[model samples]
Target: MQPINLAAKLALIHEHWMPKVVAEMNDYQFKLVKLRGEFVWHSHADTDETFIVVQGRLRIELRDGAIELGPGEMTVIPKGVEHKPCAPDEAQVMLIEPRGVLNTGDQGGARSAPNDVWI
Candidate 1:
């Protein structure tokens, strides 16, 4: 297998809301994405999701409250917790989740993206 340069891998994705898989180890996948505006309100009934900000800022809006994450910060949205992710401006993020997780969570819609794409 060719060595993967994470920086180069991340540079390949230019669209917002589309997460591209960079690497996978065990049952987890590492993803890189550029995000802006608001994402769907949803929840993962069986799995938790982790978000790590690589650049700019992000907000995870939950039913009870909201959490803001800046560069170098991270948060884990627990299983079954309803939440919506939003960013006023473009933000670069890395996500670590179970291999088959749908980015849209349980509330599937137009923004739901196919999983298992390897870069």
Candidate 2:
């Protein structure tokens, strides 16, 4: 195994909502994504999703409330809970979830990204 540089990998990403896999453990993956604006409302039916803000700010809008996160902060959205992610400006984030878990979750359309793209 080799060490993965977060910033170095992030520099390779140029699009929002598209997550690039950097590493994997067991059946889970560590992904990096750049986010801005609002994402569609959706939920994973079987697994929880973790969001860690690497830079800038982000907001996870839930049906009942919203959670705001900044650099070095993170939140876990439980399975089956509908939520949308938003970033007023550009935000660099990391996601930890099981392999094959869709970035768009239950909601799929033009905004859905490829399931597992490695950098």
Q: Per-residue lDDT tens digits of candidate 1, residues 86-105?
A: 99998899999999999998
Colliding pairs, model 2 = none
**CA-lDDT, candidates in order:** 0.90, 0.95
| lDDT by residue for model 2 (4-68), tens | 98989999999999999999999999999999999999999999999999999999999999999
Worst 10 residues of 1 by lDDT: 1-10
Error of 2 at 60 (Å): 0.4
Candidate 2 steric clashes: 0
